[model samples]
Target: MSDTPSPLSRSFTEELWGGIASIFEAILAHPFIRGLTDGTLPEEAFRFYVIQDALYLRDYARALALAAAKAPQEQAIAMFCHHAAGAIEVERQLHESFFRDFGLTEQQVRATPVAPTNLAYTSYLLRVAYAEPFHELVGAVLPCYWIYQEVGTRLATRGSPNPLYRRWIETYGGEEFGRVVREVLQLTDRIAEALTPAQRAAAARHFVTTSRYEWMFWEMGWRMERWPV
Candidate 1:
């Protein structure tokens, strides 16, 4: 790990951190997440949601691998890719189990229309992977890493009887997942610190924008609704 704080961390004002924390809190407190904890969601439907998410991760992992090749922070990017691959494995297991339980397959997941939030988030990632500055790419991806850790850890504490919830929570709440979150946070913080004030402001905007979309992603999944008209 780099001993130096990430630019984002160094530049982070109390206000900025508080704003980001607020977004995270909103996402966790979203009704969908609450429903998930209480087991009000139908298992098959929830499993379907997981299937779509797993497919998204599959593409996300590939995008990261490609981005790693051109990353200015080559060493850090490589490490991120390794960590991302591990996340992919977790998703794959979830996908397989969902398939077994719901009699759905990867092909069906591919054929399904993506939720609006799913499309928005994935598009942002691909665009960042292809066009954004190396540090900015890390900034864009950090929320996904951080939010999963936060949500997963919280759900794990809730002790749901649902086996799937147990599995999902265990995967994301584990040490390996925690390590990934730390790595992304450190990378984004480094990016923030290196920026000038104007750049830092821009970075903060990007981070918050992406985070808002993340909340929408979960909301869309939770509601299983198409994007708002």
Candidate 2:
């Protein structure tokens, strides 16, 4: 209910983000994330992550596109549509580069079953975009952008010696990505100013749920997760 207020006031998104800081801390301290900084994670794990991310981004873009369709404002639609395109572009370039360099075959990536965690994560976001109120849908989607940028910034400063891992870190930590996140945040704050307390609380719940998924996403890679067929 309470936001991270300045001496004067608190924005709903700011409060919601601050409320989730502990969860964010847990993510920052996770061994999976730590590995990206230390260059100690296994190659299979990294490859699993990259491939899974490519799969995830395709659906993630769809969710953003859905959000654009439902946005109340033209600005929201434009921003979300641009982001939806950017998501796929990032997926194509980033994952393809890693796939080529790391010897990941298209068949291998296509045949790889989506991890349970990943399936659940994307399904939830899609559901939110389809069914949740505008404010709450925005909340569910924001964590993906916000968390990656935060994690990327932290990891970028002390990058792993591994070239592949460094590439991942640098992409998220880069200024262009940061600019996108900032734009989203500004949009979030503007929408939030008009939201009711109950709506804000609901949005906060969506934000927290997605933030947890972000943590699980890293762990999903660390485990090199697969269905036990």
Candidate 3:
């Protein structure tokens, strides 16, 4: 009898997501997300979130590129590149609209420093992208796509009275976004199929850690967090 560990007895997507349920619950329970979903989130708080998201996307685009460079398959390379560019372009368009509404100048947006949680989250993804195995890095990047898609879908279904909040929800929870999430999940599952039990465990750690960061990111925005110094 061959002992190859039976391909995890489940998909890595299920395992990783199952392992993070409490964290995901915490994220879903976070007031920031709730308020945004219901159209009650403070405008300033949402503004802070959008600005930080814009900054986060800049580095996130690079991280995705790094993942693309490390991809073992031609398909993965194309997928990552497409998502990377799409991520950047979507954020640029969203930010442009928000900037016009908020009277934010390009200079001002450029001058804004990355929030602590944003830096930590994006930096962790970058480090993983650069330093980990191709499959592991792919695991690392999955949550960013997965979590936002989840959040977007939930909020979108609830239907916000606030146009701004609804717009944010639509971008994430829309059919187009769902398609992107499905593509990433499929790719992650393909990569996970080859990982050993130990490797799967490691990948789970990355997933959970990043999931926590998603929680922290919303909390950071809610608090309008700044450097203590």
The deviation in Å at residue 3 for candidate 3 is 25
lDDT of 1 by residue, 1-229 (tens): 8798665454354335566888888977887677667776567557657866876786578666765775667767687678668657866876788677778776887788877778777887888778866656665666677778878889878856677767777877778789877776666666566777776666566667778887887666767756467
Local distance difference test, each candidate = 0.71, 0.90, 0.88
Candidate 2 lDDT over residue span 83-189, tens digit each: 99999886579898999998878788888889999999999999998888888989999999999999999998898989988998999999999999999999999
Q: Could you tell me the lDDT of residue 45 within candidate 3?
A: 93
Query: For every candidate structure, what is the RMSD over all alpha carbons to the true structure, in angstroms?
Result: 4.8, 2.8, 3.5
lDDT winner: 2
TM-score of 3: 0.94
Task: Give the runs in model 1 whose Cα sits over 4 Å from its true position.
Answer: 1-16, 227-229
Q: Rank the candidates by lDDT, best first.
A: 2, 3, 1
lDDT of 2 at 37: 84
- Residue 227 local lDDT, model 1: 48
Tell me the number of clashing residue pairs for each predicted model.
Answer: 11, 0, 0
- Greater lDDT among 2 and 3 belongs to 2
